[model samples]
Target: MLSPNTTLKQIEILGYLGTKFPNWIGDDSFNNIVDIKLSGSQHCSNLPPLGQLPSLKILHISSFDSVTTVGAEFYGNSSAKKKPFSSLEILIFKNCHYFEALSMSDGQCQELTYLSIYCCRSFVSFPNGGLIAPKLSDLNIYNCPELMWLPEKMTSLSSLKSLTIRSCPLIKAIPEGGLPISLSKLRINYHQLLRIKWNWQTLPNLKNTLSEEGFPTSLSSLSISGCPLLKKIYDTKDSENKEYWRKISHIPHVGGSSERQEEDSFLNMKQAMF
Candidate 1:
């Protein structure tokens, strides 16, 4: 097998390259590559078996119109002894309209820390249980309308610190286990779950009754928007809502839709959280 140049650490394949990758593209030939970016290739129908790249730490796939599912083939041969994506830290997928599922072998992506999925309108699900990343600290999902639920056992992610979900209207609530205690920042916008009431059914009119299971005390910042019901509680006067204020008084920053900012500023602030 021909190998990449020994000095190569990063490889980027733009759309201009061709309709598909060569046969040797995702094999051990790239054993030393640390990063790979595949983007703007609308004609490509499938992804290469990138999980076999032993040293890969970052992978970015975007703008591929034909890839409908990311499954076992993308992860490589199950017979291989080495675990899939064992060294990966950052994974990103963007603008893949038809992509629907991301199925992975259980307990894969053990080293992942940052993950972001953007503008994948047709994307529907993660693995049956959830993504298993013990070290993952940041996760951002944006504009994925068909997604139904978050990863299962979210409370087990002891290292997760920042989570932002926006424009994913179908997601009804947080995972069943609730968020991990390690989370410090959270932002939810444009969701459709009014019945769950942001995990606090009585929070709106009640006094000093914050749900510990819903929002962790370790949180330093919380931002919410696009839910009319939540907007009511935050609008209360300080004197009348003393108990409500007291519940979240310890948090350093709490934002609501009332705070106005330019679109660029909003996007920049979200990026800085990770």
Candidate 2:
């Protein structure tokens, strides 16, 4: 048992084999804790109610193989008036093979600025009504092969600035109603099936747009790979590709296969002449 006078502010437990935590884990004495990370705890079927910790600002959950859903239990049902995750600013879920859905109860994530879901292959989508994070600035989803959609009405996240989706092949488009104009940087890589049919009408403020790996260079706005059809539209000179070019014409950078070819051509010309 932790001492009542304990002022511990951070806790990290990794590779724990316990099926459940001691009841004291949810005690109010942990209210001062600001960060918690539980990783590689393969036997734990459920997570401790770390949300009850009033000062918690960051949480990272990884490789919890048995946990399938994060539901009301995560918010601590001890009281109706409690506001869980009220101060959380960053949350990450990684390599949870069985994690399928995330459902919140009385939690408030308005202060959450960074959220990431990585390598959770079984994660399908958020629960209905979706996560509500009004202040989220950066969201990254990587290698979540089964993810079907982004959070509902993501346009409501007016403060969102960066969104990166990599290797989430199932996500066909952005969330309904399109992304907020506040978004400045967007990256979607290895989405072979993404149809590029999103509403580009509201993205006048988007400073940086889609690319494969790194930030598009000063001359690049969009870089695509594993998208042959888009490449065709870009390479061919015809009337049919006009709309396709128009969709991305507003972006003001350049880095992609075309740039690579230009570099190769320059090298070849130098070698042939010299």
Candidate 3:
């Protein structure tokens, strides 16, 4: 539906409209619509099968309060074998308060390049195993208090280059396996709880050494804020901690800050010690 009724909340509306609208892309219909923005509708139990639209390139959804989980219903056909949203490049979700999980299918969203999630407090998990998105290059997440863990298999996102996480208090560590070696730019702020807990062990002061364990070998840019303890482990003037500094010394840019900002993308994120 090119002109969406802002008041409509029924998931059936799109399917009904599909027959009336004939926009073709590849083997799918309703392909002419490149952008869809849905906001303030809270009654839908699941995200509509927007994934079936092969030509959709940008999707923005906000304030759909009743959608507690993102699962097979979001991906039409429920077949991992068939690529969904074959041409989508940007996907954004904001203020989805009750959103809890997202179950992505294999090869779905393969062409996506940017993804952002904002203020989804109850959101909990992403796809359990790697739902590969080879073209994804940027991912930004903010204020999702319960969504902590990054995908454990970063390698699955082979093209990921920039990552931003701000104000997510519960995420305690990077992906369990480690930051994907492919990550080039990283910005983190207000993950005070997480910065103090990246170490595999939960014990106190047992060496929360990310560089030694599995921080990426290289990054073009790095910024960290509101993580004093983490800064301590890496930024050291003490002779005993020279090794730690030496480990990350090769990075060309390093910045740190104590403040949080409304915008968390690369442009607004200033230099901070990372």
Q: List model 1 lDDT by residue over 1-274, tens digit each.
A: 5545755789998883466677677777667889999989878788988887889999999999998899888988788898999899999999999999888666589999999988999998887777778899999988899998888888777788788887888887778767776665667773443334454332222113444435545456666677665434543433454455556555556665534563334334333432
Model 2: CA > 4 A from native: 1-5, 78-80, 105-107, 190-194, 207-274
Residues 197-258 of candidate 2 have per-residue lDDT tens digits of 65444765553444332232221334444554544554434556556544544445433333
After superposing all C-alphas onto the true structure, candidate 3 shows an RMSD in angstroms of 8.4
TM-score of each: 0.76, 0.75, 0.66
**Residue 74 in model 3: shift from native, Å?**
1.4
Consecutive 10-residue window with the lowest summed lDDT within model 2: 211-220
- Give the runs in model 1 whose Cα sits over 4 Å from its true position: 1-4, 190-195, 198-218, 227-251, 254-274
Best-matching candidate per TM-score: 1
lDDT of candidate 1? 0.74
With a 3 Å backbone cut-off (N, CA, C), the pairs that clash in candidate 3 are 255-271, 255-272, 255-273, 256-272, 256-273
List, residue by residue over 1-274, the lDDT tens digit for candidate 3: 3544333332222212121122322224455666777677646666667777756788888888788887776666765455788888998988999988777767788899998888899988888885478898998888898876877687567677788887787877766555544565667774553354443232122123345534444445556676556545543344565565566565555555534332243222222323
Candidate 1, poorest ten consecutive residues by summed lDDT: 200-209
Model 1, position 92: C-alpha lDDT score: 98
